[model samples]
Target: MKYSLQDLIDMEHFQQKLIAVISKSGLKRLTEIEHRKQIEKSENRYRSILKASLDGYWLTDTKGKLLEVNDAYCRMSGYSEKELLSMYISDFEIIETPELVAQHMKKVALKGSDRFESKHRRKDGTVFDVEVSLQFRPEEGGQCVCFLRDITDRKSLQDRLESLWSLAQMTEAGPKVLFNLVLEKTQELTGSRYSFFGFINDAEDQLEVNAWSKEAMNQCRVQDQPIHFPIAKAGLWSQAVLERKPLFWNDYNLDHSRKKGLPDGHVPIKNFLSVPILRNEKVIALAAVANKDSDYTSQDVSQVQAFVSNILLLIEKRIADEALQKSDERLKLALDSVSDAVWDWRVHTGEVYFSSRWYTMLGYEAYQLPQNFETWRSLLHPDDLPESEATVFRHLKYAEPFEIEYRMRTKENQWRWILARGKAVERNDQGKAVRMLGTHMDITERKQSEMAQYPCQHPSNWYFNKYQR
Candidate 1:
């Protein structure tokens, strides 16, 4: 149709506007469909992952009511999908308080994530340990998703690690301290209600109750009693100690032989384990665990064996340390008891070693003694210095016993008669003196007593006096 220029421009503008409107509408429809498909695909992928996970997964409302659960959750609880769908999380939780659950949920809601451990009951009423991580998301109406993993085995391992750590700490302490620690740790690790330790007294040849847990000691009245088990007796712990092996008894009441062999008024040994503390292939002590809730297994035996081995080492070290301490004490006593003072001389180094007792006897402290020979020479009386030095020189040159009577000044500046006797204990290859050990004695009394006797001028005078008497 023929039209005016203005009409043609309006028509062109309307057509272009219509085309733009149509294109915008088509684009919006395509975007909406793509977004919906993406959301669906993401949801499916999440569900698939959750279902395939080994750890159980659950979605709950803020009140902790279970809204959805994955296959793993159902499997862990031994419940059917339909059954779980109808049940709330609180139904299977061993926690009785709803307030605690609310508190846990509140933490998750506030922080967006939380983790905790709690006990969960199975369909058969058995309780198991579970570690749970709860994450809060705003998109799903603020629902919380929980990731749960069974941590029973992990807890057991942690307990074992703690026991081992305790044992290591105890090893550094003394024997009595270590024995007490062992008793406590054994009761804790084995979940035993009672435990005790007894050591064999070598001189008395009797078993003595060295340490016991409070519960065990109370029940057994072990404090006043002597723990005597005859080697010929077939007692559980006695036999284990003699054989140097671990012994385990499950249902001690059912074991008639053990029941008959047990001592009178003894605590009923139920689900017990015992191991020997061995040294030099002989049982020196016995450690026993009693009244365990679970049946003792091979693992228990192995663990007890390891613990007892460490105990044996600790005991042996303790004994050795005690012996060393006693020996040191005896040596000190011996040094103090002697009337003479001991001295050591290093010839090559020209160093003098004096005992504390020597210094004290001389009215001086150990620090007063100079490390060199000059100090002693300075203290010698002038008259005796030349004779003493001559005697020592002769002895060193001839490899003979060193003996000299010298006068030394005391702290009071009085000269006292001292008999110095020494021998070269160590010698060089050329037979020269390398070291000398000696004793110094206060011989003033003896010399004065000798001088008190009547003296004869000559042999004829002594014989003439005797003939007259």
Candidate 2:
């Protein structure tokens, strides 16, 4: 216990060194703990971002077997994470086979990173376009990190726009060429394996196939396939024409009621869709496409109907242009063959040419009144004047199709329904129609039939009341 002053100083120094060492060790441990907390926080943020991203994210081995998938990927694929992990790339790769998928994986591994566009099939068996961004991370045991974005809508819009442009360019082409273009565009826009565009005969009993899909032509084995066929023989698919409505049959295979109309070796029909192109409630033409990879929906019907409308516009223009280039005698001859009555109006001179058939169709003699625009105008019923006049001027001014239905006064003082169709055959430098040629078909019987079907719905009944009054 009794010690010198120097001994006490030396003992105090030793105690101070021990305290310093302990303090340093504790500070170092605290710093290490803080670093670990920062790393964990960073990892949590990364995981949250990966989970919330709208684009699908997945990690797969070099062999194309999915190892991990995010919720977005699961939703995009219509499968759960566990289901996706159990599937390989070839299970849903539509554009490639298993061999092709393996080759693609090899290319990605060699390149380290790549971006490409491809199609993928969902669990529900519908296909969609995807943009894949992949990175081969050798550091992470050669696992591939991939991201996919759904581009189905974008790709559809782009294809539709391109189709429209192509159709517009082909408007001046003849009817055969134009119809083929339309059919091709329809198949592309709808993703159908086969398609056809056909015009209904005037009798509404036969369908004349004007254009057909190239795929159908290639796969079909029928010798000398019939270009025209009776509507009754078209089986259930003809309902679109007979019923004057659109038809969709998604499960064509399971429907035993579908008549056996396919010839031997015909391409098997998995699904079918037909949209009637209507004019004044009459099915003048129809477009049908078959065997899309998935079930056809109402959206497809709408798209086809819209496309048909554009096709009609182009067709009207083509007919007008062709008629204008023909001789008057030739044009008259052609009109006489197809129309019950014909009219030619000279816009600048206000003169009109009425065929003898026109007078007879109205129960009048030749030159009964005056062969002028006034004669046609006066015969139009009061209820139909505004729309009839607008349709005529619209075609003259805007080059729109001249097609209208109205009641016209016959010589017997009876109102007869007339389906009037025409075109502006000649236009001046100002783009105004200089001459218009049109045909008239008496459709009183058809109007009466429609009225009999639904008296309250048909406008013909309203016209009859006005005529009686």
Candidate 3:
């Protein structure tokens, strides 16, 4: 059997042998044939891989004019294959300019590759985010190949994550302010005219709006006040709360059989989404967005889920902090209303907060006394320092009740008897004293009275008699 030249060339066997044939021919014609075959094989391989990619791919020149495009790119750009071939990369880059491209090319030249995020315009003029990874193909006339992935959803998720991080860092913000921040960030995310995050009233029948977007307040609230309603209503958010799941509606006006209608002064809505903020498998709060220019989607619900988690965390922290602060205030008030001087010391840091009574008891104005451990130590008579320090160390180490008598120097530079009484008020995880609260009472008059009643037995009587001389 004989084989024709074309048949032999078409066979896979002949193609494999072409590698050897080209090298042996060493002539320009055979070399060109080999080169053409190699180019065809490369193109086939490129098309098979790049066209099948989920991301778009584009090959362009240094001037940005498109040299080639994969099927995905043509679909993404909303352009036909022929039309895209005639366009420049700039035509689709909504946020990038010639100068930016030039700068990007410079980096690509130095690094041989670069990746960045930018917005791209489709043929119909809508814009979305894209992450482009560009590689320089130096072999081909300053050509560059780009791998493009649509990152609109990823960018939105990242923005929500960043908002969460910012809110987490703002632990000092008041609860009201933090709630408003949640609404604002969510409003921007959903592109809604109104956003609401609120909890159910104790009755479980009323949903109280804790936070509302400014637009929601103006349009839906009563006189710029929060707007909430009975859970009995069949509104989108109410249904979400009752069902304990997310609900989305694109056209509420079209529904006639729904159990609820728009409330008085409520903003008219084209579309809305509502999701439950559940804790321990129970609905604790509801997050809702309404009157978005576009329709509400399931994607919007998922996005708000992330926001809701962060919001709940911040709210829980704020509530705990507020309770602690109130408790602190009550304790301080109880200590302050007394006639005795008070001092609360943070044992770990050596910081002291002295009450105003402490200054007045020593015959000085409130501002005259310094709030420091060293200041307290300086006011102690040198004779009292050793016993006072020893008592404090024993009390801190053993949780022993601290009650001792010491001579404290007054503002007049006179030694006065004081009953120093205190106990460790707080402790660290290792059972070490971290805070201590105590009181100082001026006992000079009592000591003098005792000395008069029993002059022989009182230790200070001889000193008193010597001073009298």
Candidate 4:
């Protein structure tokens, strides 16, 4: 239609405005498409990564309803993907308390994450342990993603390691202390209700139950019984000792093939494991476990073998060390009981060592005494020094037995007569004296008594002198 000049301009302007609106609409569409593609790519990558991950992945709503689960999750539960998704997360929980789950969720809500370990039931009605770590995304409508890992094997290994560690700590204690520890550790490791440890008395040639776990010792009626076989015979303990290896018996009572030598009135033995305590290839003790809750496996046997071996070594070392300590104490006591003062000399160095008693008998303590030949020379009387030094030098130079008479200062600072006697007890390969051990006898009283008894002769000569008088 024909219009005014103003109307024409308005129409042109409207046309330009419509073109701009169309261009803007096209750009908006392109942006929307790019955004959608980006979202899809991110989702696909997330799904791929979740499925390929070693840990099981699961998503649940705030109500704990299972929304989705990865293949790993389904596999862990022994269920198909569809089945897991159809089931609520609460359905798999061994604990039915919703309050606990809610509390955990609250923690996750506050911190955005939570982690715990709990028992989970599988599709096959079996139970397995799982460690779960959950992260919450409130922006995603309070959705939670949980990562679950099967830790049954890890838990079992941890338990076994703990048992072994307990055994080791127990064995570190002395034998008398370890007796009960060994029995208890064996029972715990083997899951046995009863266990006993018997040591063979080398002198008596009899077996004695030195230690037993709680009820095992009480239930075991045989103690101090002669070890016989087939009838009141030595059980697994004897067998292990003879074999020097581990023995496992599943259903000892039911196994007709097993020879029965159980004592009368004794409880029937069920599953049993036995190991020997060997020292220097000889079986010194026997450890036996019985009435296990389950059949003993090769793993149990191996663990018991290791346990027994360690126990044996510990016992052997403990006994040897104790004996050595006892012998050393006895020697020390003997040395202390003697009247003479013992001394040790390093010949090559010409250093002298004296016991505490020797130093105390003199006017000094052991540390206060001079440790070299010069110290001894300083202590010697001027008159006796020449004779003593001459005697010692002659003996040392010729490698002969040493004997000398010297004077020493008493605790009262009085001179006392001492007879020193020594011999080279140790020598080097070149026959040179390395060590000289000796003793010093306080002969002052003896010498004075002899001098006081002057003019006394033997009985026959005394009778002749008496008759002449």
Candidate 5:
């Protein structure tokens, strides 16, 4: 159609507008297609990631029935996909029953998400620890997505550390206490129902049963558990000690030539593990656990070996401490019988530990004065002090002989002759004496007799002159 110049311009404007609208719509369509592809890619990636995850991923209804399970979960639980789909969480859960599982599901629904630890039973009935993280989606037909990670090894390590810490704290509690703790911890860490700890006698022919786990004692029907038995008469359990190695019997019920039927009223054994505590390739002690829910593995053996080593150290330390204590007691008795007094001196600190006889010899109550060099100095007779100190200084500096007869003031204000003999017990890095141990004997009578026999040589004058030379 023909029109005026203004009408032509308007039609041209309208054409331009139409072209712009078409271009804008085409761009919008292209953008929508790209967005749809991106969404599909992301969904595929999410599905692939969920399927390939090493941790078990499963979807269940609020009631705890499995709706979908990943391959990883099927493998972890030792069940086929079809079998898992037909079962409920209660079927595989060891810690929580059907009712408890339902309660947990409700709690997760209320909280939207939850994380917890629980034990689960495998298809073969072996129980293991699992850590579960779950999210509930009410919009998705009240379903829950859950991820489970096996934590059996982590839990086992935690148990070992806790047991070790406990045992370390009880190292000084006595051998019986340590032995009982070892037995209890062995059972706890290995999931055993019974355990025992024992040592082989010095003769190497007898087993001295030291302790039994409380569970073992409760279940054992023996009228009286024997504490000592000849190794030759023992059953296969003693083989670990005899062979000087560890022994494991996953199927203890099976007949073996060495299986001397258990004693009457003994707790039935299904599986057994025995580990020897050896030093220099000789078995000194044995630790054993029995009746685990599952077969014992090398890990259990290692755990028991660590425990045995710790117990051996504690036992040896205890023996050394006991022997040292007895030696001290005997030494004290010997000194008392001879009426001598013991003294330990820390030269640098001027601290002195004087035995009770040291005070009693001076006619004073034990520890009546501060045990220090100043106290000894105050008690020394002034006339004998310079000679006595000179002799001590010579001995400390030159490692010369240290025997002297000095006069000390007693509680009764009487000067008594003291025969003092000592030797450096400890030295510094510079070879200087830092500690000295010595004995003191009241020698007033001997001195008096010597003076009476030799009137020209007075006891104090004789000692002073000899030390001076």
Candidate 6:
């Protein structure tokens, strides 16, 4: 039953009802304060999770304007939280233009999410590659949430793989240019201001320059100098070569006795590193770098040594290739000097390489003859093949040098006496011939002259007797 307002006002207990109504109001206010406290506690938990994330993250409106940024995002951008929160998402990208970012966001909304690698510009004006995952939330008025992971280290590995491939391609460039490239790349890779590379000469006493980088030359401001840099003249460069290992001087001034000081116009070196290029325990070349920004450490020494060790195979191969080329030239000159022919047979492959002089001796071009045993069999006299084969088999079996006089059919179809001398230069574990090297010389005139002087009734018999195999 409801009491009328006049009835309540006239009752004596109306003041007690007023107190109860005020008490109910105070209880409702207390409940609301507890609810607000719970909400604040949950918000704090959410913020802590975001702040502790390893990946950088931020929230943006559909218009790409940044609404909220996490601590990670601030740290990643090299910016403070207040500064990043004031900027737009588009402002962080170094590669993506404003128009491009707009297009990306449009596509991302259609796909619900998108992930890609792009460069991000830091506040310090440096850039690094980042993997960005963008998510669009239709529930929040098309807001975009993004997570970023830095991939600069991953990119560096890819770059190193490319560098190895480039080094492989350097093989065809010849050892001289290849060495130059190696030195230049080493200086750049090691962050050195100057590079020095010297190769030991034939005398084995002098260190001559095989390659010098243009950058080192430019940095040192030298004119047609730093050439040779003899082993006796240079201090650390020579010392490294003598030690047959890598050496580093963190401070050249502290050890004045070891340092001869830089020559006029040479680069003023700071921390120094040097390594000897070894082949068969012999120091054949020297490589050094100097003038680093900071003091050299044991890690620097190890890094340089590892780098040199990595490319040692290529360096040795290049040196061998150069030596082989020079050897071929000298062999050619020697053969030409004596007007002799040369042939080498690789037994394993059953293939033969004939020198130009060998082909010219038979009045045939080098390319005209197929590089196989059949070429020799076909050009040799039928009677001479059996004897030559028997002689070769016996020599290979006995490990003896085969020196025999045989008749070879020339291009003109005339029989010419040739003195063939050959030996198995390389062998396998079983003592079987893997390779054979030899030379052939025309002895028809000498035999004929001996026969003429003997003046026997049978000219062939006289020639054989006078020549005496």
Top candidate on lDDT is: 5
lDDT of 6 by residue, 23-56 (tens): 8888889989999999999989987887799988
Local distance difference test scores for all models: 0.75, 0.86, 0.81, 0.73, 0.87, 0.76
> Which runs of model 4 end up more than 4 angstroms from their true locations?
1-41, 56-101, 115-132, 139-141, 148-174, 200-208, 218-244, 247-256, 259-272, 277-284, 290-307, 329-333, 343-410, 413-438, 443-469
The number of residue pairs in model 2 that clash at the backbone is: 0
lDDT of 3 by residue, 1-469 (tens): 8989878778867777897787677777778989999999998997889988889988888888888888887788789989999988777787879777777777786788888889988887656789999998787668788999989889988888898888878888888987888788777888788887888765668888887778766665445453576787645568777777898888877764443766667777777888888877777788888877667777788888888778778888889989999998887778668989899999988999888788878778885867889888998877779989999999999987799998776786666788999999898899999999999998888988988888888765665565434
lDDT (tens digit, per residue) of candidate 2 on 1-469: 8879999999999999999999999999999999999999998898789889999988899889998788988888899988999999999999989999889888999998899999999999898899999999886668899999999878877877777777777856887777887787778778898999988988888999888888888988988899897997777778888778898989875655646667787888889999989888777888999999888888788778878778778887888888887876686667656648888899898889988778888899865778889889999988899999998998788778889999899888989999999998898887878898888999988988888788988755976666535
Instruction: Give candidates' CA RMSD values in order.
Output: 10.1, 17.4, 8.3, 9.4, 5.8, 8.9
Once superposed on the true structure, which residue ranges of model 6 sit more than 4 Å away at CA? Answer: 1-55, 62-83, 90-92, 97-99, 110-112, 121-127, 179-316, 355-357, 365-368, 381-407, 414-419, 441-469
- What lDDT does candidate 5 reach at residue 317? 95
TM-score of each: 0.59, 0.60, 0.76, 0.60, 0.76, 0.61
State model 3's lDDT. Answer: 0.81
> Clash number for every model?
0, 0, 0, 1, 0, 0
TM-score, cand. 2 vs. native = 0.60
RMSD of 1: 10.1
Q: How close to the true structure is residue 332 of candidate 5, measured as C-alpha lDDT?
A: 68
Q: Clashing pairs in model 5?
A: none
Candidate that beats the other on TM-score, 2 or 6, i.e. the better one: 6
Which pairs clash in model 6?
none
Candidate 1 lDDT trough over 10 residues, lowest sum:
459-468
What local lDDT score does residue 288 receive in model 6, on the 0 to 100 scale? 81
Candidate 6 weakest lDDT stretch, 10 residues: 458-467
